[model samples]
Target: MEASTSERPAAAEGGVAPMVRFDRVTKRYGALTVLDDLQLDIAAGEKVAIIGPSGSGKTTVLRMLMTLERIDGGVIWVDGEPMTHMPGPGAAGSGSLVPASQRHLRQVRGKVGMVFQHFNLFPHMSALKNCMEAPVTVLGLSRKEARERGAELLSMVGLGDKLDHFPGQLSGGQQQRVAIARALAMRPKVMLFDEVTSALDPELVGEVLTVIRKLGAEHDLTMIMVTHQMGFAKEFADRVCFFYQGRIAETGAPAELFGNPENERTRQFLSAVLEAG
Candidate 1:
């Protein structure tokens, strides 16, 4: 079937087009469906947090956007352009949602950057080198320019003095900060954080969250975070989506959702989470 180009009206202030859209998107593994016809839209410069119980498929949303996992059905749009599929060779608006070619995927995927729960820094490379490698290699930036950018980002994450340190030498928070800098070096339009603070020690979580808060306050990037840090989500996100049974069961402004959730599932989930904390 030809992929539908229809999209929800721009929901941001001033009617700007959505930065990301998931239209009837589905993901399945064997007999289990991880994401079932999930539909979501994110406006440019918006901060969205995905939160739910363990099997609610919150992380899958970000993973699918990063192209780390393939969708079984439907389409995903980034910047109003087809992400999972490209326009076909012939007629206008005639393309289907076929498996995207590697070249096409690479071109579109560059618009996104993702930081994971575990610090995925190169253990052998110094923090500066780890931050510089991608910009120099994939982005084709000059070594000197990449280094400058890397140094600036590392410093922004409060790691200027640790530029020469390896991941092993740095604490969990510091290494995660380096990973954030590395992702930012690519200058992605959309940033995804998948449980970025999950692996950190209790005290260390604040440092990473502080950096993320600064980014949300200062930058115009569209940020999507999958996190269990309820307090951080309430404070940092403009909207919080509660996923249930592989679908977004409820979503609203942070205050509304956390303070007066409309969905029973959401209320129950929040109650349990709050009780656990």
Candidate 2:
């Protein structure tokens, strides 16, 4: 079930370079350590799943990548650029915090887009408008161009007919799909899904998963997801990283990790989750 190189659309194609790299990155909240010296590398167009217990820091990785949370230590590189360092005014001779300018931050941040668990759609706007707003406001796309791209994305998510529908008028599954389309409008280099289906009803979970599966199968977007859906994770993820106590316990091909786990923590966690599944 791996997608072929030829299957990638022009928009999805990219060099086989490391899109993101986390080198011994650690995050802390006050005195509490959330991520303990985590090291990870995500290649272009690769789909990776992060699985762990409730407090295992799964969402922290996504938030850090989105730059929503600053790393307490270590560095993160995006598309071969140093995100933690920026140029500052040269102190009398030479010494500065390399003032991380907001302009530089915006440039790196623009390459990543995220879909949260809650459908963070603008409730006041129609589905089409929700998707169009960012492109027009941030990317400076013309109204006509943004509308066209929004329509295409809505069609891609099977919501072309619901373009005029507000978030309140849509079902949980439909709203999630719209949120995804909105993210795609940004044409990001990396996409993050943080327990996106966790908020949906049991029956609606499959619909959102179906959209994600299709994304993995057809699109070349580099995706990093933190999900509890073991079945989908097993079948969809090219690689899976199991975390334990804020650290990566094990990482490998999904078949090897899920079918023949190596780490004891992963084995125990997989057994518990799969049994409940």
Candidate 3:
């Protein structure tokens, strides 16, 4: 059966606890190295913005955290549990030689929610149905319970009236909002946003951002966002990280990084993006 919100396990809470930690992670796709040895720690309820030029592995960070992409080396820990750990080939742990078990991955994935650039809503379903599908299927929620929960989530995202609308009937911004609601339905501990507003119309960006801003304030979610919206990054993030050449180039508070960047690469990047904006 699908786990109820009350029964769902959340990530670590309280002060100074590392909700998510990436320890010396590295990922490579053949000759192309996507992520270098990287280490990052996100405290409970912290909102972190990952800003970088295109191809700087911003999205990869989110994907890796979600376990959508496997790490080539090192480990990830969530809520004090190892995310990608298993016994070695000839070692004994968790009963068997499998490095990573599907069951473990499912548990890990359930705690992490990811919102993609394009709202990947099911074309055949209405907003309500789209939101309820995973809960009912993967989590074993009854359709009625899922419907109620889904409606509540849709309403929370300012789409309560649009539950019956299909993706084709909604604007890009509305669709993305629904996507956010769908991810929220999982009651995830960590929410990963990958250029969430990048695909929206310029005028439609604010609504999506407002919804996110509210989420940041209202929930104790560990959020790691990959975004190009410099203004939003400055206002929403507790700390801003600049990635260059598949590594973190600079990281600091919004004021320190945006007002007085220590890295020359970060300075150049902000200059280019500011000019473009």
Candidate 4:
């Protein structure tokens, strides 16, 4: 059920390999199958927007990539390496893969960074300290180096003056910006935004999206976003994927898909969303 425009070539025949690949990945919770054999590829530096109704498994995609949820079936590859499994007794490219060790998972997962809907900043730490913790501990960066990197990212997100403010002291949108800066401090190759603006006040959404727009323009990072912001997606994404029943029912350039959707479900969904809005 993978879908894409003719302009976007299939992953196997592409000029460069995909930065991330969900190879027949599946996820289940008890009798509920959340993601069913989902196969997708994202090239390096691509901006992909995933849109679907609730319970269609959009957020699960990011969670799986972040290793917050394990798959029931298939391999998830990141940066040409398997994140869910490791090569078994052979060379890295062509060989059997067994379930990955914790060390292997940690190594591969380091390439991805995710920002969830809610601003999960620590209330006790200043915005600067929140951005600096991971680099200092996980990446083994010295306090001096982490501080510099953290400050740079915070400033990039337009929070230079609020670095010393704790989460409770800042607005919701401001806190989310810090979360983005914190994620960027790790220098991830892939960035995932799961309904990042969903929890923001209506007027505040623009500020966060503005920062994201700047990020896409300035960074080489691949960005994957699952969002309901149709206007933003239409303006910002390189590709739009419409998920239905846990699979992509339609995908194409923003103008092509939004203006002339081929799938009935896609058209109906868009109509409902537009009407509701």
Instruction: List, residue by residue over 243-270, the lDDT tens digit for candidate 2.
Output: 8888999999999999999999999998
Which sequence of candidate numbers ranks them by lDDT, best first?
A: 1, 4, 3, 2
Q: Taking the tens digit of each residue's C-alpha lDDT, what string does model 1 give over 1-277?
A: 3444444335567678899999889999889999999989899999999999998899999999999998888888898777887765563554434556789999999999999999889999999999999999999999999999999999999999999999999999999999999999999999999999999999999999999999999899999999999999999999999999999999999999999999999999999999999
**lDDT (Cα atoms) of all candidates against the true structure:** 0.91, 0.86, 0.86, 0.89
Best by TM-score: 1
lDDT of 4 by residue, 103-131 (tens): 99899989999998997887889999999
Global Cα RMSD, each model: 1.9, 7.3, 5.9, 4.3
Per-residue lDDT tens digits of candidate 3, residues 1-277?
Answer: 1111111123445535588888677888888998898888888788999999999998999998888888787677777666776444554433222335777878877889989999889999999999999999999999999999999999999999999999999999999999999999988999999999999999999999999999998999989999999999999999999999999999999999999999999999999999999
Where is the poorest 10-residue window by lDDT in model 2? 1-10
Candidate 1 or 3, higher TM-score? 1
Q: Which ten residues in a row have the lowest lDDT in candidate 4?
A: 1-10
Per-candidate count of clashing residue pairs (backbone under 3 Å): 0, 0, 2, 0
Candidate 2: TM-score? 0.90
CA deviation > 4 Å runs, candidate 1: 1-13, 95-97
The reply for model 4, stretches above 4 Å from the true place, is 1-14, 90-94
